[model samples]
Target chain A: MVSTARITRQEAEDFLYEEARLLDERDFFPWLDLFTEDAIYWIPIEEHSDPTRATSILWDDAQLRALRVHQLAHERNFAQSPPSRTVHSVTNVQVSPGDADNEAKVRCNLVVYEVRSGDHRQLGLGDLRALPAKCLYVLRYEERWRIAHKKVVLINRHMPLINLSFLI
Target chain B: MATQQATTQRGYAELVEITDKTFRVSSRVYREQEVFEREIAEIFEKTWVYVGHDSEIAQPGDYKTAQIGRYPIILTRDKDGAVYALLNVCRHRANAICRENYGNSQNFRCPYHAWTYRNSGELIGVPDGGRYPEGFSTRGLSLIRVAKVDSYRGLIFASLSADVPELDEHLSPVKEHVDLWADRSIGGEHKVLHPHRYAYLGNWKFQCENGVDGYHPGIVHESAFSTFGEFGIGNFAARDLVKRGSISRGFPGGHSTLEGGARDGRGVGRGLPHRAEEYQARLREVYGDDRAQEIVSNRHTFIFPNVFLFDELVRIIQPIALEYTEVYSHPFWLHGVPDDFNTRRLYEGTRQLSTTGMVNPSDLEMFAANQTGLHARMEWLVLDRGMQREEVAPNGERMGNYSDEVPQRSLYRHWAQVMARTEAGR
Candidate 1:
């Protein structure tokens, strides 16, 4: 029920920044609304490995995303008992034209600094981890820009990773 | 410092104390640097440690790098299709020969000085050969090979010690459990996908003890069970399996199993329903009804020292240090099952067991917490949950209730026996 206007580079950048803000703020329920109904939030184990054929760090559909939110909210989910305090810094956003005027492919560099806040000083919790990744977002305009797909390719994808119980 | 008594063989044997009523492990076993080093020597280096699966190196010249205790190894298939586990160090110097995790190559040329070795650990080429002394034979210069290499249903294991028992003998205690898992494919092969590797701040045996220790799922994994239950999403550790009668069985070796009392095994038909049905029917055709039913029943089996085979994935525990451990979780794909089914399996497996899975992170948290808590002056950690109710089966397995420390007791018994071995005993 809206115009099929072309999305600009500024609009894509703003959308990505807002998304990053929501994630860093831990406003998960509101952030979930930014995605399309058939959204695919993926963090692939390997950049080139087929998600259908290979294992992924995370491949959350709407149902899974909701389930994860529920899990995080549960009182006994000790993995996130203290909940990570994260600051996501997004930069170098480049919006390229998509197949349609209402769609665009937005690429950006993301660095998230996360620390498990509270009394635990364990290796995974007390330590401040800086996760760097290359993020690609497929945006579609339906009155406003909504993410159809979000892929975060971590730099240390093949290495031994620690507690990634939080949204990255 | 009193626990520093572990410098001797008898001291290692004393780490576990078992009476008719109770079983306890020394806290020093988790907190000591010396105990960890001795374990690498007396246990992992001496036992048949899993290296790689046969499916990973299906073709000739296929190769993968692995580690057994502290030693780096290369697992390769030669042109003749013979598999070998070779030390990855160069013959000339101690430089590593293969750096890549896995690939296919007939020969590996060292980055330093270009010394080369064939896939079967034969010295094929060496640069500047003329500089060597006269009659400096290359016979003994080949990559130092492991003493024994063997596989059971595609799971390869290697031993560094020549005095150890044969791999078959070592694996005999849990072969039936292994067969039930492997035979699920009907072709008797499992294709291991790329691993989801994660590290934790805890002793390696924590992973070993955690895998078969059935009591924790009801307590530690409360959120996961509750969440999955509310959504009706099936997982390996379901609540009903707890309410029903899942049992814990421990073998003579350190191996143990968490046998689900459920008929269809939890999470068996949750995803890819049609494919699951097809897989079941096909398994029944080859193995008959009773065997097929046994195959479908849940069995989370753990082999001694390193590997665990759950319904969804194969978990390899790699000990790094006294308080650090690395785990590799590889989702299993049935050989003849359609790719879609395997994909669903991967998704479900990783969903629960991956680095960021709903279940694994909490376990990691507990392991780290346990490691930190062991710094207390308290000396013993009890492993006596269902000891009174434990019964010995005809097959030699000690069976206990679903939430029992029987498996942990089994692990410690074997651990003490292995650690207590002396040069005279060998």
Candidate 2:
């Protein structure tokens, strides 16, 4: 059985910062380890969507998440020919108790600034785009905190976007 | 020949060169602002452009907004269930009357002057009407209606010029294929769900060429297929695509298709492994086994100028400029199918085609590269792949190997023909 301990706001904030760091530093392999087996990394088109029924920007299970990471890291994946460099800013962490004793729900505002890393300063590839999002995370503790679900709703989710190949 | 003479007179004849042995398109076709402007004037404005599906505005007052070239259009189902395409601009001050993407409104009141118009584009109420002159009349001031509007199998199309051929003439070559796509639903109706809207930095024609060009999938989407292979998610034998009988076809009016070969009995439906049996069973009950099997075979149908009907979704391409285009991919639900079936197809469609999906981003990346590369001094790009092996079917359609540029050749041929014609029929 998992421990029924209350997760503090600071602890949840710290956990989010580490996850954000892993993504920003492009350490996707280790970032993949932070999720539970059944965890979902979802970026929904609408604020609330039935992932099974409705379309999303992304809805990845453990298997798909791994595939995405592999594809990003692959040499021939020219979409990331000069892989995107991103800086994730996570703020306003508000943690609350979840329905399960081992779970806690945390909400925060996030801004991710992404740009191409190399000399390819083409229009779509070079622009420093900012993705502002309202994010929600459900953290569960077994031995340590693991993400059960992470939902990201971009401020401009409904608008048309460019290549979002990098992790957001 | 007459159209070519007219285009030559206008000094635009050198863009595309065609001979018995070779077919070539100028790089300027992808790089020039003048050529882009002429395309909007000569091709998009004169051809039948897809607007929205009939299912989108099924009820009275239901409406959706769209674009044909540079013109903004509103497609509406009026009180009598008649569908019409009207310019979205207000007749009075040139302000747009309807600003929302979609809604059910019997009347649209212009925000600038509160000039209200009925769903059918009749000027119903002009606020403070007494201030106008006595000779003024609203009769000629209704929103400008598109010259031609028609549909085939619930896919609506509008043309700015009535001088164009009837919609059937444009769609005849691909009507049977369209039947197969629409008949996936037992009732022959499909619902367009919300779309995954995205844009790329490339010429619009690049997308038009890419959709039907089957050759690029092996190289462009190698990463996606490899990832899928690693997970054992689907049987993505990209190498066996040709031996499996996949084929590319080009019709006369620029429409094209990439059809799955017969060797893959499950066809592209392999994407949704769990729902295939039940879905095929339901299809067989409605259509006989042969027809059901044909319907099950994967086909990506590109209907000339704007839209693609493929794999349980409709992808629309909108051109913004010489090197800017927007795409909308809407995964659709078939009528008379189980929710699970629709849901699974939806997931598969969005998984590979959405803005952030593994497959399409690679294509978009290539589009950006192609746009950047077109600036080089190279004069021509080759479209001669499979020219020797391509065959003309009894139906007058051209067929070639799965990796052939037959579809691209057909697109440019038709584009050249359309670009040569004058609106005045000179």
Candidate 3:
């Protein structure tokens, strides 16, 4: 059984920073490898709502993510010709106590500023409350820390949005 | 109305000298505040503007709020299943009654003064009723109803002008096209799956022109087309076949349609390695041999002013300003088809063509460039393509071949007519 108390706040912050680095560096394959096979990436369309009923900007299973990654890598994607550059800032990392032996809840505030094709874009500001975003190597010692779900709730839900090509 | 008259006079005189051969429009049309105000009063206020679909307010007390030009209107379904379009402002102090975008509600209470209205838009409560005079009647104070609220094939539309033509009359030639869109649904009932809405920083007319222009598909979407080709899906060379054929342009009343199939529709679909068989089989099953063949292979048609009903989806254009436009796209399923088929249709339609879709970003880029180009030193942009080929038919439909500028010209013609009428009233 993994102890929620065992993972320090600094360790959680480091994991988030590394994850951000992988994304900013366009190391998509490695970034995708962080999620479990069954893990979901959801960006909800409504604030504090379930993704099933309410529409989402993005709701991708592993296969969809793979296809997106493939498209991003391809040279023919016109929108990505110049490629999108992003800097993700993660802060306010907080760990909540978990009920399961191997699970713990981690929350962080995120602000992603992106620029694509010479145009500056304000991607979004959101809070990610991911459960079981496990410690990378410590999963064997504590099964509870594996990520079960990662939910992103953006500040603007109803407003019109441009492409969400880059990960948030 | 007075301001509408003055603006119309100026617009009519300017449009009179313009003809089917004219390509560049006066920059004044895009920049004049008076013209914009007149359009709100004369066009948007008078005509029946599409609001939302019946499915949006399916249950009793379900409501959605939208804007009709500059006026805020609420669309609500009552207990009796009657849908109404009423002013969103309260009768007492004119404060907005509902702040939420959409919700299920029994009654709306104005936050300013607590004036309460029923789901059907009837004023039900006034705080401290005894304070009012005896003859003061809440009966006359019910939420002011929009002049007309009607639905065509489950698509709801409302108009603020009492004198505007009937809904069916206004739709006229375009009704047939709209029917084609809804005919796919079982029981001939089509509902919006809540639209995929997005905004573009360009004039709304640019969107209207983009959907009808077949010339740009191959050029602007070269990247997407090339990707499809790499996937063994579609070949840009196949589009060359249509280039040899004449562009067929038709105008039915104020509505206009542009029709031209790919050189070989079957060949293009065949080139797409993925889902080709599935799409073909579904088409054959739904349309049955000959009919399905025709349905699957046809050029796109635009119903003037604000709607574009493509073979697979419908895009409704709402103008936010001369420089900003909002588009709402909804996918329609062929009635009686398998649920899996509709799901695939929705998936393909949204992923490929929606605002945030695979092909849309490039299209948006083109629109942005066009918007920027309009600011260039050139007084006008050319629209003279196919001017020599325009032919007037006995039925009043102006016909032109595939590569013609006739469709854009047709829209300007309608614009001129509406603006002229407003001028005459002055």
What RMSD, rounded to one decimal, does every model reach?
1.9, 2.8, 5.9
Clashes of 1: 0
Model 2, residue A13: C-alpha shift (Å): 1.3
- Tell me the lDDT of model 2 at A34: 98
Listed in order, each prediction's TM-score against the native is 0.96, 0.95, 0.81
lDDT of 3 by residue, B235-348 (tens): 444266356563656575456665554423442133233545665566567667664444454456676667777655667888788767778776665555455555555555
Per candidate, native contacts kept equal 0.77, 0.77, 0.18
Candidate order by TM-score, decreasing, is: 1, 2, 3
Query: What's the lDDT of the predicted structure labeled candidate 1?
Result: 0.85
**For candidate 2, lDDT tens digit of each residue in A65-98?**
8988999988888788888999999999998888
DockQ ranking from best to worst?
1, 2, 3
True contacts kept of 2: 0.77
Error of 3 at A1 (Å): 11
Candidates 1 and 3 compared by lDDT, better number: 1
Indicate the fraction of true inter-chain contacts that candidate 1 also forms. 0.77
